[model samples]
Target: MEMSELTALLTPEGLRLLDALGTVETTDAAARAVSTLRAAGHGPDLVAAVVGQAHLRAKARTKFGEFASRMLFTRAGLEQATRLSVAARHAGRLRTAGITHVADLGCGIGGDSLAFAGAGLRVTAVDADEITAALTAFNLAPFGDDATVLHSTAETADLTGIDAVWLDPARRTAGHSETRRVAATDYSPSLDWAFDLATRMPVGIKLGPGHDRDQLPAESEAQWVSVDGSVVELVLWSGALARPGVHRAAMVVRGGHTHELTAPADSEDAPVRELGAFLHEPDGAVIRARLIGDVARHLEAGMLDEHIAYLTSDAALTSPFVQSFRVREVLPVTPKAISAALRAGEIGTLEIKKRGVDIDPATFRKKLTLRGPNAATLILARVGSKRHAILADRVDAA
Candidate 1:
């Protein structure tokens, strides 16, 4: 079936069939939904979500599960995958911003919406797809009447007395391609329109982490958020929600690790401290937010390079964004030099880490035949034009 046909089938009939037969409490709903779509001879890829959604409804063993049902999942959601922790990261930002109420624009199956409610915030979840809206309503039912699920495009969604708006615009192009071809203006209307609507209320927009930095507003806080060390989504928070020039924030969700860094508004010099034999790389969010100065003070270290985000310290610093390693041996960045050291110590397996270097870790490892038991050393070398490798053991010191 064509894309338009698949979209049409998701209305009235498809929703009714799903509602009538999807109330079961098990993953078997997946098979049943697939059976229905197969019987209809619909595009298998098109209905794959229907199948997974069926399973999801049945898998609602927790309060959060009930909330996830209202969200709309795209092909990317399936491919890149969404988890409870990841969704909670976005919801946490809402809570941190002092938002007591939310308008969950494009609420896919209500995953993040549910999280907001679970975090004790009221929600108005909206979706253009009828089936998705129905699922959202059903999932949001446990939030009591405080949460409202609407069947409307983000453009027409009522925004009366809303505390905040969150939009995850569809980024995928037609034809199931991962790349987005729709111009910002082609988003049913335009991102500018969405931003205007948001300016009327507090708003948070979720975009691909690879989104163009040039297009972001001057006053917005563009945050590149990562959960468990992996960068997930780039978030745009308007001044309506948080004051402008709020240096971007990098949040590491797991372990509840957070580091706030801020640069001078006038681009003043970042105070450099002494290099204490160890360097730490701040998380992307911290670097983007220009919070390196604060991070340096937090770590009690100075900049190894005036502009680099790396922090150097001798005293063991316990920051989540920075890793601590003890330099076992500092050697030149050459195959022969590295090989000699590795063999002398009988270092067998090498964990190669390089920065500002062109040497491939795999190629370097293969050439060295890195073999040795027990401890290891770091090799510092310029891959092309700079010296930037540090061989170290994962020690307690920073």
Candidate 2:
């Protein structure tokens, strides 16, 4: 649907119709609401506004009903909702680290702040956008009056004496669509300013997983969090907030159960193993935690390479941080040979995963004309080089 049509369906009359209908669950409800508003002779603009507003409100409520706060509707704000599990895990870590108060810098729509308050920490939430700050107040209103929302950039925001600070730098411009021209340094509350704030307060900053390692401070602990096997966000913690090291953790919440994969700080010994019947690739978090070696040791498996993170064995192994898959076949990396092998086996549909391979999955899929069979192949590469493909059946762990 056009944005204009969407806006027209979001009018006062449209909102009234929606409210009268209670909550929207079907497209028919949306269509009927639009039809009713249009029949009532409501202008297109009001209709559109009401529809848009309802959609946003419904989305916010659906995603964040557990916490109360206003919506910022920014890219970063959306990312927060998407990474809620990661935020909650980070909050748990902070609680363990003895942080009872948090100064949430750039608190767009109060995403992380909600998690902080949910963790029972006092929060002083700050944002640069006036509307966002107001929305933050509204979103945080349901927390039973313990959260304070502020409208100001971190540079000028008063953060003195707060136990911890959460910083998420704005990565977009006001106009919204000109991101190609926007720069990270252009944030009103710059990273330099955030770093300075970290020195005085326990600070946890949310950054893109692809952020430069050089940009990270030498004394900070950097964590990469993934949910359901998908890497989502990278968190940086200062000494005041956490101990120094490269920490990687998978924040898994399955069926109301929560688990994490963390490497012990003291264990540096790698795993030793002889060839086994199956190889297990540790989860990203376990790899990031630098504990795959420990996991290998725990499983009595050998590393394919000291630097490479893949573990191999002839015996069955059990670990939370890795998935065990039985090797069906191994082949040298070649387009024609791989394609012929796939075609000869009548394998039509395939999932190609590569770690060290230089070929893009999309490009390889196109080149091989893969289709017909249901199978998944893992393309392991050298530590820094790409390895050939390993066609395998995923071992059901549970």
> How many residue pairs clash in all the candidates, one count each?
23, 36
TM-score of 2: 0.76
What digit string (tens of lDDT, one per residue) describes model 2 on residues 115-218? 88888988899987765676577567767667999888787877666877888877566521124324667755777887776776688887765666667765
Model 1 TM-score, 2 decimals: 0.72
Candidate 2: C-alpha lDDT: 0.65
lDDT of 1 by residue, 1-398 (tens): 23453464356665565555554455565666677778888666546645544554444433234433443343333333335666676677778878888998877667678778888889999978665566567667878978999989888987888888988775555322154556665654367876676566677887767676677776676766666566677777785665456636565554555444433231232566544566666666556555666767777777766745666777677476656565556666778887787788787766776555567777777777566575564544342345755666665422
State the C-alpha lDDT per candidate: 0.63, 0.65
Identify the candidate with maximal TM-score: 2
Candidate 2: regions farther than 4 A off: 1-39, 43-45, 57-76, 80-82, 175-188, 243-257, 263-276, 288-291, 305-309, 334-349, 360-387
Candidate 1, residue 312: the lDDT equals: 72
TM-score of each: 0.72, 0.76
